[model samples]
Target: MHAITIPEPGGPEALVWAEVPDPVPGEGEVLVEVAATAVNRADLLQRQGFYDPPPGSSPYPGLECSGRIAALGPGVSGWAVGDEVCALLADGGYAEKVAVPAGQLLPIPEGVDLVAAASLPEVTCTVWSNVFMIAHLRPGETLLVHGGASGIGTMAIQLAKAIGAKVAVTAGSAEKLARCAELGADVLINYREQDFVDEVRKATGGAGADVILDIIGAKYLNQNVKALATSGRLAIIGLQGGVKGELNLNALLRKRAAITATTLRARPAAEKAAIVAAVREHVWPLFEAGRVRPVIDRMLPLSEAAEGHRVLESSGHIGKVLLTR
Candidate 1:
């Protein structure tokens, strides 16, 4: 099998195409022949040597992939060879073959191709787990999503709106804001030109946002709390802006709000399996019904994985950037 490997780990140039041994499936796992993988921020960080694969996990950078089942592991059931599936991978999705736990595999949503479905797992699971499962975003509540035009932001906006929430989003430019609006965002803020806290407060008539899905961690921490409504929940998933920030304990107490943060890659297999099961049962139908779909910006060959990383780093993409087999 051929895979994208990092020779050292620094820049896009670090990614090199090389032949590797075909991975064998383990108990309760399946070997998927990769069709496509998407570039994620964490992949970029990993390429730069800031992160590494978990023990016994793939050393490749992809967190998700869509493909067919080439073989099944011992103890796996309900799926067979040649099944079309998409999987949430901890890593190793950049290769032609990846061994994945059967529980992490999901059927390709109706009306989607295997390659495009690769875009769904990371963003869908991330937003659903954080915004709905962890933060408890409810219908009619006001939700704020940072980086609105990015893959996760686009999915977050659509999902929040589909569930009857008023959505607000912040991006770096007017073009991105407009894209968010087209996805049903009620309020859009250009973070570079406007203060998001004031904009969100005014948009919600001084009530503040009921939930905020934040990517910029420390930089937005104070402002996020300021923008939250009474009893609001703030779920931080990324620290693009930094990792440390001061919190106003007085404000948190006054608003009776709460804060939470998590990373999907670091979770146990059982927890991830739970999220996968819940999504398959609850959210898969939305995709099947054509209500939700992967937002794909561009597609590149798997051999050009470094270029895909470069595109993500440039922030030139509106949605997902895919590397196809």
Candidate 2:
């Protein structure tokens, strides 16, 4: 099998395609012949040596993939050889084959191509778990999402709207904002040009947003607190801007708001499995109904993993960038 290996931490140049040992399924796992995998920000961070795979996970960087099952480990049932599926990975998705926990596998929803379905798991899981499950966004509520044109952002917009919630998104340019609007975002703020907190507040008639899906972390912490409505929830899923910031306890106390943060990679197997189960039950049906779908910006050969990384770093894309096997 062939895989993308990083000999050292650096730029896209560091990703080297080479022959590697094929993975075989272990107990409770399945060996998937990879069709396509999507690039993620965490992949870049791992390539920079700032993040490492969990214990016993693949050294490769991809976090999600779509593929066909070639072999199943002992005790696994309800699936068989040649089943088309997509799954969330702990690591090692940037290869021709990956041994994924059977519990993490999700069937390719009807009306979706297996190759394109590779872009769904990570973004859908992230948005659903964070915004709807963790933050408790409800109909008639206002939800704000940062990085509006991002993979997570695009998915978040569609899901929020589907649930009857008002959606607000912040992006760097008009083009990205327009894309978010087309995806059902009720408010689009150009973060590079306008004050998102003020914009969101005004859009909501000075009521502020009820839920904020934030990625900028410390950089937006202050403004996020200021943008929250009474009893609001702020769910932080990434720290693209910085990691630390001061918190105003008084402000939080006044609004009775809550701040929650999490990362998907370090979660336990059972928790990940639970998320996968919920996705299959609630989210998969949306795809079949054409209410939601993967938003892909580009697709490149597996060997061009480095080029995929370059596109992600450039921030010139509106959604997922896939690498095919």
- Highest lDDT against the true fold, candidate: 2
List clashing residue pairs in candidate 1: none
lDDT (Cα, tens digit) per residue for candidate 1, span 1-325: 9998887989999998999888999999999999999999999999999999898998888999999999999999999999999999999989999999999999999899989999999888999999999999999999999999999999998888888999999999888888888889899899888999999999989999999999999999999999999999999999999999999999999999999999999899999999998889878888888778788889999999988998999887898999998
**All candidates: TM-score:** 0.99, 0.99
User: In model 2, where is the ten-residue run with the lowest total lDDT?
Assistant: 124-133
For each candidate, what is the lDDT?
A: 0.93, 0.93
Off by more than 4 A, model 1: none
- Writing each residue's lDDT as its tens digit, candidate 2 over 1-325 gives 9999999999999999988898879899999999999999999999999999999999998999999999999989999999999999999989999999998999999999999999998988888888988998999999999998999999999999988999999999999999999999999899889999899989989989999999899999999999999999999999998999999999999999999999998899899999889888889989999999889999999899999999999999998999997
